[model samples]
Target: MLAAHFDAPGGPDNLYIKEVDRPVPKEGEVLVQVHASALNRADLLQTRGYYPPPPGASQIIGLEAAGKVVALGPGADGRWKIGDRVMALLTGGGNAQFVAVPATQLMPIPPGMTDTDAAAIPEVWLTSYQLLHFVGKVRKGETVLIHAGASGVGTAAIQLCRLAGVLPMVTAGSAEKLEFTKKLGAASGFNYKDEDFGTKCLEATKNVGADVILDCVGATHWQKNLQCLNTDGRWVVYGLMGSGEIHGDFLTLLLRKRGSLLASTLRSRSHEYKEELVKAFTEQVLPYFSPGGSIQLRPIVDSVFPFDQIADAHRRMEANKNMGKIVLQIPV
Candidate 1:
């Protein structure tokens, strides 16, 4: 088996493909021959030594993958069989040609979807779905604000909000990205580099403000995010692309707005929790991707790079140049 490994934590230049031992499935796990995997911010952080895999997880960097089930471990449920097409959310190790994932994390690929596209769904889409439905508790007719609207999760969040009959507003750094969000069903988009998105969101909602706010930019946007929230609003923070320090009177602001502040990270969660999330998402969202379903949530792939070019894929994501997921096609 071949996988991308870094000599040391630093830049993309340090990454190289190396032959490694193939992983074996544990009880209740499935061995997958990976066809494709997608990039995420966590991958970059791991490369730089900022984020490490959870206890007993593979040291490989990828967080999600799509592949075919080649074998099942003892005690695995009978729902899956050899050669079933599946995608999975991983705590780590999706970069390799083969990985062993808990059967509970495996999701069947839709009838018509390709492996490359299915590879892009698990991480971003699941994160967006969890934030919107579980953490944010968004309801129909509510206005939701999403930051970094051009990101993989952002694109997914926009579409999910629309599916729930909620109005979504987004903030991006470029005009083109804003337009992209609008096409995905955002009610309004703001270029945060040029405008105060908080003020714009409030005005667009006729001063009522957004009912739920999904933010990844931590300290830099903290104050403004509070200002944009409606009373009893929920603000879910999943990442701190910006610095993590809070400089303002955050407690006062939270009390004043009656806001519910939540911090979440999927990678660090327990296996049981992830299993529950996968089950809920499989039931509620996966059907939409099936043939003849009411909605088709296609993954917006920014670019695809061959396995050997994994370094370039990391470079693209690190530069913030990609509009959606950057995929790596692993050759079998």
Candidate 2:
């Protein structure tokens, strides 16, 4: 099997294609014949040595994939038989021809969903769903602000908000990206490079302020996000792309606004926690993407590169040139 491997990460240039032994399914695992995989910021971080696979996870670089089941472990049920199409959020090792994923992590691909499109759905959708429903506690008629609204997670979050009948105020860097998010059901969009997103969000909600703020660009937006929050609102911080460190008077702001701040990372969660998220996503969120549902994958595939061009893909993401996911096609 050919896999993207980076023995020591420094840059995308460090990634290379290697002929590796295909993994066999262990107990409670299923061997998937991967067709497509999507890149995430985490992939770029993993390539640059800042992020590494969790303990006991594969050292390969990818977090999500769409594939077909080729084999299953003894404890696996017949529900996922050989040749079943599925998509999953893997901890690692998705940028390969095959990967062994825990059976519990797999979700059957919808009847008409394409493999490439399905590949882009899991990680971003699951992250958005968990942040909105579980962390943000977004309810219908509420207004939420989402940064990076043209990103994979941003795209998914917009649609998820629509499904929940919640209003979404989104921020993207480009006008075109803002338009793209609008088509995905974002009630309002802001170009953060040109406007103050906090003020824009508040105005969009008629000065009531956002009920929740799903933020990835931390530190730089921290003060504004806090200011934009509704009283007792939850500010969910998922990433810190702007600056990892923050130097705000958090106690003063929290006391003044009476709002709660939550910083969450999905990757480092316990197996039981992840399984619970998967279950909730499958039950509550996946249905919204089903046939006739309002929310479905609208993958903005910026480009597809061959396995060997993994480095170039990372460069595109780092440059912030991609509107959506960058996929690496594994050759058959």
Q: Mark the regions of model 1 whose C-alpha exceeds 4 Å error after superposition.
A: none
What's the lDDT for candidate 1? 0.92
True-structure RMSD, every candidate: 0.9, 1.5
Worst 10 residues of 1 by lDDT: 289-298
The residue-by-residue lDDT of candidate 2 on 136-253, one tens digit each, is: 8899999989999988888888878887889988999999988888877888998989898878877888777888899999888887887788988888999999996779696798
**Highest TM-score: which candidate?**
1
lDDT of 1 by residue, 1-332 (tens): 99989979998999999999999999999999999999999999999999989899999889999999999998886968999999999999999999999999889998889999999999999999999987888899999999999999999999899878899999999999998889888889999888998899889999989999999998999888988999999999999998899977999989999999988889888889889999999998888776666766778899999999999999999999999899999998
Clashing residue pairs in candidate 1 are none
| Residue 6 Cα positional deviation in candidate 2, in Å, after optimal superposition | 1.9
